[model samples]
Target chain A: MSLAATAATATAAAERGFLSPTGVEITFVLVGLVTLGAAMVTVTTRQLVHAALWLVMALGGLAVEYLLLTAEFIAWVQVLIYIGSVVVLLLFGLMLTKAPIGRSPDADSGNRPVALAVALAAAAALVWVVVDAFRTTWIGLDGPAQGSTEVSGRFLFRNWVLPFEALSVLLLAALVGAIALSRKNGGAAKNGGAAKVDRTAKVDSAADEDSGTPGASGKEQR
Target chain B: MHLAYPAVLAALLFCTGLYGVLARRNAILVLMSVELMLNAVNLNLVAFDVWIRDTLHAGQALTLFVIAIAAAEIGIGLAIVLMVYRNRGSSDVDRLRDTAERAEPDAPAAEKAEVIA
Candidate 1:
């Protein structure tokens, strides 16, 4: 009787629905909720850096969805790029800008009501379409072989070469443009007497001065 | 488990991201919101890819490229933001409206001051 009980227990463990398909479904719901909430706050947050941080949460949730689908490569890429680099760049921009660190009216003004309505309408339409298109469709396990790193690499280098090359060129152009823009802005601010850039720099510089050396300007905290 | 699970998650995420993009006034936050939207798109791609077995990773492969482009975009975007902060002072994207009206070469000196001040 004990042997039978033990066998039953083992079988139950193996069949634990939480570890099965049902588990994946529950996780999907929970992650979606969290991602949605974070994405909302990412835009609503008053602080620039705080918004960027919330974006990280939203991006991470997407990664989780990728993992649930067995797209391991895409999952990792999501983490490495969106969370790792994209957000960091956003923060860097926030830091460099002269926007009020505490509370700036300029950071919180827009036609929010209209925007919200439009966004909601668009989302509702998209959901309706997607749901209609695949209402009763079921996933077929035997459809395609799961992607391995090797196969992914081969496909990228082989069939998607044009797009890949185009992306690279786009990035290069953007890089050069960003550099030129930055330099030009720096010069323009000096020559044209812009207060926007200087205001942010002043606050940062003031903070720097208070901490250690006084009367120094534009020397950022290390 | 229903395939609708991941789809719902992606939709929710995308909606929230859209709200952020529309509501947030901070430039950095706007960029972050854009990232959020992109991630939501990625989620949809992966989920659909999973549901469609015949395609065999096409969706996921596209997602990888999206991630790569997102990374590069962030890099250059950050550099631009940093520069903007240096010249304009604050990162409030709303203040950028005036500059957008005036072409780059013809942007007024007072407009720059208004942003930094």
Candidate 2:
């Protein structure tokens, strides 16, 4: 082959390699951008409830990213656990605390600039480290999907069973501890005064009212 | 595809969460920030799992454990925050500085005893 033809072929091959983004990669980038935006809103929103809602979006986007990455099981688990349960739990906590439904000026501190600076520095360092470490690595898409439930389950049960059981215990302990902590300040408050108890009960009822009409109605039914 | 995309995304998410943790006063928001960080870690784990091509899927298994731990953490954290709000009427971490106040009254007596001893 002529040198000119050889150079042209080589250039064509390089162009083909560089310019083609697989559908999965494009989807990944789009989902990542969406997730990032949602995360930003979750952090910066003035409304506490809105932040929680935005968090749902962020978590949901992560699930979609997982799906695009071909981790269907992990994606579903992310959806089921993080979005379905955790966000609801957070909303419950919000209601239980009687956090304002609208804008919460106290949500943000005066340290935003400092925090931003630190965050930017940290992010830069992390990205640099990760990209530098794995610059040329490519995930094989043609092989048996490594992220399936069966593979993950086998891996978890076979090798990680002990830690998995330990996690169950930890979860149980956390559940009990949470119940203990959030239970009414019974004995401590009883020592104060009947009037004080009544005032607290009234405040609790008022907070419940602010949560929603259903909660208020439930209290009345009780 | 390179692993850098997801890794960098995770880094950004983690940094945003860190900023939220540092800049937010609301205890619940802080917990949310913590969730963000945990999610970022999960992303990194899965990305690395795929990049390294571990047949055992060890990274995803660990990610599962991390998720479980995160759930537990949030449960206990939100509970503690609720208890604090119940007692103090606000979830602002700044206002909870008085927790050490109760121990302050005994400090002087202890110091005096120490000096005498």
Candidate 3:
């Protein structure tokens, strides 16, 4: 259906020009702006947990972009996998790392100016190239929904079966790793500090002793 | 929808992630930046899938695969970060510089760095 629509646009180019913005285009741009802003905040926030929360907004905005494009299955999957699990897992990681509850002054490294310059340069090049290349191309969302469950599952099982199986194997490997983590946790529950110190002795510098504890090594470097 | 919208958005988002990866101090925040980059690519994939209308739906399928790999990667990455924190008692990416090129021609520092690793 989208194929037909693209073909139709060849003759109907005048019907949908860039000057005449569609509702979907307007919504996409607005959401894209919000997503971009949230992403900016996620990277810039001083508080560690706030970065994770803002990441949720950025990711959710992308999910909305998926819905606007009429890729229903991908949209739902974005919600389920990204928002439901990834962000929560990130929060858990922050907690496990004992991130500062209040704003940590040294959230960003000293190379922030360099990072900003590089990011801006890259964004400029990419946006310019994309807009110049695809100025006339159009995506048709009016067709029978493309990314429905039936379509995704069928294509996945048929054409993408091998990669799908390999992915499952990878998940199995992750599960095993998770189990190892739990067992390690249980063992470390007792004398965890001792185990950590023993490891730290090998990994950290001997001079680190003159410094504060190893936990403060991060700040010491800062 | 104009194809450029998603394409342009993906490009901008990817760059934002690049900045995050470069500027963030904590390893976990770096990982978050990596997630942003991955999500931008996923958005691009879904958009192209809708636009091209391929018979096999390769774009969406690939997006799913990317998501799974990202999950596994984050798990392993966190494990490594946690291990670093346990040994060094910090997750700062800038600190654990045991193997950095020695400025001085001192043999003892090099030897110590070698032993620590």
Candidate 4:
């Protein structure tokens, strides 16, 4: 009896049974719930600013989830990019668009019922499929950190260097496009204004290209 | 850890984003929903990377790439939204119907006549 008990215990330990719930798993679930709740509130909130704030919470919770998953570099990058810049950009967008400070009631469209039904159906199908597929799958997080800085840097530079450079180029292109879109149609307004607009566009693109790509690429180090 | 947790979470999050995208009237809110969807994809990528432990670490690499792409997308999206708001004085997605088909019988004929002229 004693020998069998010892054998069973060892086997269970080797198996890393997750039904019992490891510490990491528990933390992950708890954080996931918070993240989901925040996300729900973000989409459902009446106040525009509140929605953006709730988005910050949801995204910050995701960053924590990344940390829990042992992707420390990605976690920090998420915080830096999503929380730091993206949320701020969204807030700026809200303010620039003149979103109401208080409740504006028409936040949701007329097709909300249809939207909810579609989302529910999608969720059900996706959950069923994912759970069925990954029911027995397990992630063994026992060894050295898989997503540490050195490891990410190694694979990033060794294999993904070309794509990394290409992404930076893409970012540069996006910046130029943004400048083009945001600049007023000065040319259409006044013919002489076209030269003025061209010079300003050049300056704006140069400034953005000089400062923006590096900040994004620095954290987005793939 | 069981792979179902992150997978399920990501699926739900993506669905929530989908609902937001379809339901939200404000273009900025729609953009927010898009970000949520992208984040869900990133989570799924990271979880799968951790699960498979690929020699190339393709999942995490792709996650980073997705993040970068998402950033670029948001910038361009916001710029477009801003220009739309400036032009039309409102950022409501449903209100923008410049390209929508007209229900009137003569509208198409009139358009064709203009084209012919």
Identify the runs in model 1 with alpha carbons over 4 angstroms from their true place: A1-21, A98-106, A140-145, A188-222, B54-56, B99-117
Error of model 1, residue B58, in angstroms: 3.0
- Please tell me what DockQ candidate 4 reaches: 0.41
For model 4, residues A97-185, the per-residue Cα lDDT tens digits are 78999998999988999999999999999999998887766676777888998989998999999999999999999989988887743
User: DockQ of each model against the real complex?
Assistant: 0.42, 0.35, 0.52, 0.41
RMSD, one per candidate, in order: 10.9, 10.0, 6.2, 10.6
Tens digit of per-residue lDDT, candidate 1, span A158-192: 77888889988888887787777666444444422
Candidate 3 residue lDDT tens string, A97-207: 799999999999889999999999999999999988877777778868888889888899999999999999998899689657644433332333654557546454534
Q: What is the lDDT of residue A49 in candidate 3?
A: 97
Model 1 chain B worst lDDT window (10 residues):
B96-105
Q: Tell me, by TM-score, which candidate is best.
A: 3
Give the clashing residue pairs of candidate 3, or none: none
What is the Cα-based lDDT of residue A107 in candidate 1? 53
* Residue-level error in angstroms, candidate 2, position A59: 0.5
TM-score, cand. 4 = 0.82
Docking class of 2: acceptable
At residue A123, candidate 1 shows an lDDT of: 81
By TM-score, the better pick of 3 and 4 is: 3
Looking at candidate 4, what is the lDDT of residue A138? 69
Q: Using lDDT as the measure, which candidate wins?
A: 3
The local lDDT score (0 to 100) that residue B101 gets in candidate 4 is 61
lDDT of 4: 0.83
